[model samples]
Target: MKTKICGLKSLREIEIVNKYTPDYVGFVFAGEKRKIDEEVAQTLRRELSRDIKAVGVFVNEPLERIAKMCEKNIIQLVQLHGDEDRDYINALQSEVEAPIIKVIRVQSVNQIKEALTLPCDYFLYDTYSQHSYGGEGKRFDEMILTEVYKEDLSQVREGLQKPYFIAGGLTAQSISLLDNRLKPFGVDVSSGVEISGQKDEEKVREFLLAASKVS
Candidate 1:
């Protein structure tokens, strides 16, 4: 599975993940525990290798700010994880050069059905309930994902389909199912690797290694 390390903060952590060579390195542009400021993001952008994509995570940020951050940070990918609608997303896509990944909170079958209608470069399936929108670090009912989770690769490649990144509460225990059989475009992880609000290198390494073992 292509891996994306989100909630990234320190240069040391980003450098550690480089050995694993994760496909995407994300910076939290909003929310608590956000390690860096706009200036930090700009600096980190230069340090990131061309091969490794950079993503900016925003939670219902103003369009002007989002546009500015994307430019200032030089991030090429945008992951929106809030109540942003199609118009907001479309506006960003039109303004920014980066591709947009819309996060869909999976709570029930109906939510899944509605997710397919969103216009985005990628679809992120995350845990959601009455309380939050995304990044809660708790899992939703995986059984609800059974149909699409088990669907064949060919079926997943058909129309209205976009790349998939399974997010929320996925750790070593849940990484195995993301093998080729599952055919997820990538995996998105955050709190699963934390010890106490900081990125633990050992946990990060193990998570990557375990996920890499899947056939």
Candidate 2:
């Protein structure tokens, strides 16, 4: 499985990931404590190695703004974590070259079914929170994801498997528990690698090392 480190802030944190060189890193543009503006994200993007892609997390942000960011290549991927509809996504996809990853705060298998209709380059399964959008550091049942995977594949779609990443409260140990029967595209973690409310280099390395062992 691949690895994506989300909610990265500060040049120091960026430097750490640059050294480790994960598949993707995230810059939250939403109204969260970890959120970063366009300028800051741009600067950090410049500092980031070309091999490591940047993902911008947004919640109900304007379509034009997101398109512009992708156009400028500040973020290679857009992770929509809001109530954006198909029309909004279609408009953004039509206008931008960057791939989109729709985040579904899953509470059950029903939510996954609802998300399948949505067009996106990839899907992210995160823990649902009634009080917040995401980054709650909570994890949903992995068994539910296994079922969703089976359900998606049962349709006999063109693809053998639907690409997706599992987020929320993910730790190195938990990543190992991912059923070998279902292979997700990647794993996203934020608070799991944090220490004292910030990204800890040791924890980051440990998480990546642990994830690398997963098939």
> Whose lDDT is greatest here?
2
Model 2 lDDT at residue 14: 92
Residue 70, model 2, lDDT: 88
1-215: candidate 1 lDDT, tens digit per residue: 68888887877777767766788988888766764677888777777777888898888988887788777756878989888887888888787877888888887765666666666788887888566565578766666666555654453344135677888888877777543444567888888888787777888888888778864
What is the Å distance of residue 64 in model 1 from its true position? Answer: 1.9
Task: Give per-model TM-scores.
Answer: 0.87, 0.94
List RMSD in Å for every model shown.
2.9, 1.7
How accurate locally, in lDDT, is each candidate?
0.76, 0.86
| Candidate 1 lDDT score relative to the true structure | 0.76
